[model samples]
Target: PFRSTSLPSSILRSVQLCIQLVSILIFVRVLRSKSMEEYSYTMEMHQSQISDRSMRFVGRLVQRRTMRWETIRRWFPSMVE
Candidate 1:
């Protein structure tokens, strides 16, 4: 008779464990989505940096193309600024 009463309590404990596992799965999914958003934001930052780096390269190329200059801004970029 006591065993029959304990059986229901064990079933209740198992149900609680299943609920905890489901909650953990939900938490993991939310974390994955948040990480994906951060990854995309970093990608956009990299794209902007590429444009900025290209602009600096363009200026250096123009200096090299035009050999006629008072100062050697080609060698010393600080002088160009």
Candidate 2:
């Protein structure tokens, strides 16, 4: 009778340990996935910002070129005509 009770108690303790280990693993996995998602989001934001700045820069460059052409036309109307 003593051995039978002791056997059941030992088995219960092992089962408890397995549950604890599984819980810990799941927690770690969740944390890692959250961090990865955050990292990807930040990267996307940075890329969008960079692209926006480049587009603005190109627009300004085109405006400058158009202004230069207008100035040339004003200076030498006969050449254009």
Candidate 3:
């Protein structure tokens, strides 16, 4: 009975601490990678391949401007809207 009473108090303290930490994290400024800078760097690295029929980066193929309208519609559904 003594152990059970102590356990609830500790659990309540830990729950309060977690709630505070989460609130602080929510207001904190996020410092992450500059994606646009990396994108430009990637483009520069593949400058020669940019003119090819298709460009491969990682595993995704940046396809060439296809003549088919269906392909474009499939790629970006919002374009039709």
Residue 44 lDDT in candidate 1: 44
Model 2 segments more than 4 A misplaced: 1-7, 35-81
lDDT tens readout by residue for model 2, 1-81: 345555777798998899878756754664465333333333343344556776556445544566665676689767644
Task: Give the distance in Å from residue 27's predicted Cα in candidate 2 to where it truly belongs.
Answer: 0.3
User: Which portions of model 3 show Cα errors greater than 4 Å?
Assistant: 1-7, 30-81
Off by over 4 Å in 1: 1-7, 35-81
Per-prediction count of colliding residue pairs?
Answer: 0, 0, 0
TM-score of predicted structure 1: 0.33
| Model 2 steric clash total | 0
The TM-score of candidate 3 is 0.28
Give the clashing pairs for model 1: none
* Per-residue lDDT of 46 in model 2: 39
Q: Candidate 1, after superposition: displacement of residue 68 in Å?
A: 57
TM-scores of the candidates in the order shown: 0.33, 0.34, 0.28
Deviation from truth (RMSD, Å), model 1: 21.2
